[model samples]
Target: MLGANASKNSTLTLVFLAALKGVVGFYSGSSVLIADAVHTSLDIFASFAVWVGLKLSLKDSAEKFPYGYYKADNLVSLFVSIIILFSGVELVREALLNITNPVGMKLQGIALGTAVFSVITMYGLSKYKARVGRLIDSQALIADAIHSYTDVFSSLIVVITIVGSMLGIKWLDSVGVLVISLMIFKLGTGIARDSVLTLMDAWLDKDSITRIRQNVGSIQGVKTVGEIRLRKSGLVVFGEIEIEIEGDTNLKRVDMLSEEIEKIVKNEVKNLEHLVVNAKPGKMSVMKIAVPVLMQEGLHSKVSGHFGRAPYFIFIELEDGKIKSWDISENPASDLEKKRGMKTTEFLKNRGVNVLIVGEIGEGPFHMLRDSFVKMLQMPEVVEDVEKVVEKVSELSTLTAPTE
Candidate 1:
């Protein structure tokens, strides 16, 4: 926001000063001074260009420019620099011509006072603009300020040279133009260089990148930082990051982590417009492992007693003295046990234990078992004992169809 304000302020200042200088130079018949005034006036166009660039670059990301137009600011800076460069070259040409062909100046107290006033205003304005540019990190605005500062200093030179001429020191006025031209040329080069760097899409300094990594890596659930990329259009910055996390974590967790990273990056990096995160799951070292004996619960006592082996069927009697269902296969050592790796439904059928007492199960196998009519005790974990689980199922069974 400050960046936008700086551009606005620069545009207004440039136009005002340019017009003032032009009027004064034209009436005084100082071609060199008039040239400088016109040069300053041109800043109005450059300032407007910067304003447009800053505004457009801040637009939200779209399909055409996924990263938004933040680079437009850089282009604005380049244009501003070019404007200064052209002005400098033109001023230098005028100064050389004036040196060759002497022009008499009609110096007066009023003219000197006006020049002094212009000098004061230009310097004061440039100083304020420079400070504002620094505050907002605006290269184009800073360039504009430098342009104003040159005008102020050159105005002073023009005044001093004109006064010296009134005192019969004729060569001093031409010398003043040369001095002013040199200053303008130096500032022009700086603006040009900064603009070029922006156009090239250069990354923020290394320190900034490192700081972003540290801030993002500090987020919870983020194990490491893989890639962090940065780009700028006008006043906006776009960032891309790859974060590392545990493999087993779900999508919801990843989304939360991404939001956190975005917040951190935005807080640390000013003018950040868009942040994109790519989550890379941490690799799992152990793919599969076997565990010791598993416990069984919520089954009939008689059914439990047949765990060793027999005709494969065992009836677990309920607490109400009513038998719920039978487990046809009880022996894990039976010949049918050799086909163990089969799906749960197929394995249970071969075991002859058509009924099962277990906790919640998923749809695929549960529906398969229902089709077999292998009456199941869909027990809730609230049941303390295995028998209780079976009883709950038996209690609900009459309301539903029985399995074959």
Candidate 2:
């Protein structure tokens, strides 16, 4: 809203000023003022283009444009640059022709006053446009701001021509045209350069890329940030990243890791519209194992007589084959009349259980376990102690081999 209003206000004011310049220049017969008046027409056109682009750019993604219309801002900016460039070329040719054959005129006071008023008005418009442009991160507004600002410089050149004519220097009006033409040309070229680079999908910026890496680098299970890319349009930025995780990690865990990375990066980076995090399988040391037991026994405790009916279970966390930590919690569904096995399997899966060690598991939970990719080791008989059970699980499950 702010950007739209700013563009509208600035363009309208330029239109009014251009009208004043055209009428005044025609009466005063100053080629500089006349060319400047014509140039303001493009300013209005460019401003409208930018306004439409920004409006469309803010729209949501549609089936036809899956990536959204963010590129509209840059595209319009590029088109506006062409408008200014062509206007400048025409202005240069006119200025050269006027210089070759000077058109003398009865100097009118209205022209001088109009030139001064235009300079003041355009300067004000540029400042307003600049404030609104930065506020909303609108590329179109910024480009338009530049165009209006250069018009102020050209207006000042017209003032010089008027003063020179008053001082009886016949050629200064034509000389003013040459300087204004160059100014307009330079402005067009600079804007075009930036628009083309953005359209080409150039790197956003070094600082922004660093911030993205910093956000994703510290996430758990993200072994390495393999690739990070962001493409910016208008105020929005789209990103994609590749992260390395353990090759043995379950699919469910990988999914969780991918979501975590996306969340962290989006929260940290400003205006990141959407992020796609690809979890590349690699090797790492994070692993967990769970065993159902009748009691809360110590690390080397004995296994329970049954799987789902175990009153308590011990969850062991290991890093690089060595025990890191362990916890015991009561199995809430042990006394349930139905679905106890499935419920217990869910409980273990939520606790990051990669492998399950049990004496035996029912068919229903067994299928659920297989679907969740939980490595199950059904010992033929209950083990005498946890040490024996751990040894058997480490050897049987094709995950990490726990060290002695």
Candidate 3:
């Protein structure tokens, strides 16, 4: 959306300036000014190319283009590059012909004013487009910006040639055209190179990859990170990660760990989306543990003192010494009701909760919970924090050992 808007704005500015320059250049009989005006005219077409690219690129993924239509932008950028290259070659050919015929020019004040205006206007538009391109990471916008900026340099040369015409330098005007044509040709090649690189699916920024690795690796039960694959969907990047788990864990535990890692990575990495995660576990089964909590803080959420009366439960599905998917669910049984403790115990068992960590519990509910294979642990005195509670759970697994 932003790219299309910027391109439209560029087109408006170029149209106005090119018209003004054309009238002045034709009347003043300055060939260099005329060529510069032609350059500005071609810019309108280039800006339109960029706008077309951005529009087509906005299409969503379909059966045909499962990856969406991001390549439309790149394809258009390459097309514009070809246009610029051919335009430069033609301009240079015409300039050589114009140079051979060297016509005298009158010092039209309007021509000088128009040249100055073009330089200033193009300079401002170039800056605007460049800033927008950087903000959105739109390669097409950046390429267009470079094209506009090069026009500013060419306009300055046109101004110089106009000054020379006033001082009896007849051939200097054609020389200006010669220089502008060569510079335009050079810029065209550069833009084409960048566009081709994007079409080839070049690697993304290194910092983004690093963030994905660090964030995913930090998730509990992710023993090591491997084979992080990335692809760009316009400015956004999607990744597929392969992770190895530390101990023998069931598929259920591995699945939870994958979801947990995806959440963590999405939270940490900017403009990154994880499409898939694969976890391979070592030789150990994870113990499903539940910790009663007063509330969920997302990251630093603490455990609660009361087992059945807590407002929420911080459930940890642990594999080996690591925690995966520390989920939080509201404790409906915590509400005042008859046999709420028994209700809590029943709730824990039905939900596959194997272990409960509590600061306090009643004998009736405690005994009932154990009958369902749901073990109980006294919450460590130092386990007031999330990290400490995780440590306590890790300790619980070692103490009780794995049953499955």
Cα lDDT for residue 381, model 2? 59
The best candidate by lDDT is: 2
Better by lDDT, candidate 3 or 1: 3
Global Cα lDDT for candidate 2: 0.76
User: How many times do residue backbones clash in model 2?
Assistant: 2
Q: Give the Cα lDDT of each candidate.
A: 0.62, 0.76, 0.74
Candidate 1 stretches greater than 4 Å from native: 1-13, 58-69, 131-137, 173-183, 284-404
Q: Write the per-residue lDDT of candidate 2 for residues 194-275, one digit (tens) a residue.
A: 8898888776477866776777777654557887887777667778888776434566776777777777776666677788
Each prediction's RMSD to truth: 14.8, 7.6, 11.3
lDDT of 3 by residue, 214-271 (tens): 8877765567889877665555557788887754445556677777777766665445
| Pairs clashing within candidate 3 | 248-282, 248-283, 248-284
Q: Which 10-residue span in candidate 2 carries the lowest summed lDDT? A: 395-404
Q: Compared with the true structure, what per-residue lDDT tens digits does model 1 show for residues 340-386?
A: 22344454555444345543344554555544434455335344444
Clashes of 3: 3
Point out the worst 10-residue segment of candidate 3 by lDDT: 395-404
